[model samples]
Target: MKNASPAQMLLGLRIHAAAFVATIIVLFAVNVMVGPPYWVGWVLLGWCIGLISHWWSVRYHTSHRTDPN
Candidate 1:
């Protein structure tokens, strides 16, 4: 993992977060269009929280990193 450049890591994070948000939007839209249960909202909420933490870690935790040369 540490072998990856910072750009590579950030790119991965951007893609992963975009995909997750898109998937959550689709699931919520499907739930609304079809009907009840409303489970997608809960799932979205949970995943959103997790994504926030992941983003935070990627952005700040790696900001002060040093190259392990």
Candidate 2:
């Protein structure tokens, strides 16, 4: 069986979580910045849902992803 190094696994997970959160934040900000096209709202909502799902899956194993700054 192939075994993953702990550091490699942690880095892989953090990368995915970061991407998920980044997408949500970017889309949400864009929605807020650009007033109602309406569909933008839906896109943001979808991103939020995806972010939530990502968090739920990884919370126990990898609670904190990035620095505040």
Candidate 3:
């Protein structure tokens, strides 16, 4: 955990974010993209991504870092 480098951290973010971004982009690109059928799922997916990203950010930051005075 602590040994992971900055590039690793970035790679983690990119991989985690990829699905969220991809779903949204594809949904938007499709003209049928709409309320319950499309946007709702994507929004919920985004929320999940947000939560996961937040958790990973906090986890990696705390894991890699030493407390400062």
Candidate 4:
């Protein structure tokens, strides 16, 4: 795939973060209903790592981007 522009990368990161938050909310509700082990924390931890990585990638790309001019 062609490389994404910095704006596209940032947009993707935002979308990913929003999805993560939404999913975590649903998972937390399910965990509360289940009333036990509370696996939402684990899911949150794993997804957080991915989200941080996505953020770092966007930061790196945007900082390193070179102008075509």
Per-residue error for 23 in candidate 2, Å, reads: 1.5
Model 3, span 1-69: residue lDDT tens: 345665676666677678667876676667364444555565757668796876678567857676445
TM-score of each: 0.77, 0.44, 0.44, 0.93
Model 3 error, position 6 (Å):
2.4
- lDDT measured at residue 35 in model 4 versus the true structure, 0 to 100: 97
Q: CA lDDT, every prediction?
A: 0.82, 0.61, 0.65, 0.90
Candidate 3 residue-pair clash tally: 0
Rank the models by TM-score, top first: 4, 1, 3, 2
Best by lDDT: 4
Please tell me which model should have the higher TM-score, number 3 or number 4. Answer: 4
**CA displacement after TM-score superposition, residue 66 of candidate 1 (Å):** 1.2
Q: What residue runs in model 4 are displaced by over 4 Å at the alpha carbon?
A: none
**Over all chains combined, what TM-score does candidate 1 have?**
0.77
Runs off by more than 4 Å, candidate 3: 1-3, 30-38, 41-45, 48-52, 55-69
**For model 1, how does the per-residue alpha-carbon lDDT over 7-67 read when each residue is reduced to its tens digit?**
8778878987999979988998999998887889788888889888877867775787886
Error in Å for residue 44 of model 4: 0.3
List runs of model 1 lying over 4 Å from the truth: none
1-69: candidate 4 lDDT, tens digit per residue: 028988788889999999999999999999999999988999999999999998988898789877888
The predicted structure with the larger lDDT, 1 or 2, is 1
Steric clash pairs (candidate 2):
none
Candidate 2 residue-wise lDDT, 1-69, digit = tens: 014444655666677668866876787677778867646666657766876675465554444444346
Q: Estimate the TM-score for candidate 4.
A: 0.93
